[model samples]
Target: MMMNMFFYMGLVSLIVLTLNSKHLLLMLMSLEFLVVYIYFGLFIMMIYMNYEYYFGMIFLTMSVCEGTLGLSILVSLIRSYGNDYFQSFNILW
Candidate 1:
């Protein structure tokens, strides 16, 4: 009960952190945190439900791929702009 509440609160806080962040790196980090939290939630659910997690495992793999892709993009952006701050990215305008 209390553990679930704390888990949900952490998720909400991670979402707020991602939304309120101004730096690309911070936002990306928050997104990664969100992914990890989701994975943990799914893991707990699987334990209690005692069910096969084919979809969950697939989703986790996809999430890991997505994170790595995002990191690669961030690397390129940093290389081009010399910083990970959104304000530093002027290619959009």
Candidate 2:
């Protein structure tokens, strides 16, 4: 039952990430949500399979790094352009 709930939450985050990607902050938040869901799923799987938690730790570390990178990028973008909207995020700039 708990697993199913987390699965649905992950699905919702994925849908939000797909449908509403206009703001960098929102996208990053959804990405973080997905990462959290993945970590939870991994934890549950490890418990059920009686596997070592080393992989989960690695995954969590990587996720945290990714989140920090995303936030840094967002901060830089905001500083440069004063907005987080993807509409103004020109690739050629």
lDDT of 1 by residue, 5-91 (tens): 867867786777757667877887777777777787787789899989897989888998989998999999989988888877778
* lDDT for residue 21 in candidate 2, whole number 0-100: 83
Clashing pairs in 2: none
Q: Relative to the unseen true structure, what is the Cα RMSD of model 2?
A: 1.5
Error of 2 at 68 (Å): 0.5
Q: What is the lDDT of candidate 1?
A: 0.81
Off by over 4 Å in 2: none
Going through the candidates in the order shown, the clash numbers are 0, 0
Top model number, TM-score: 2
Instruction: Give the Å error, residue 4, model 1.
Output: 4.7
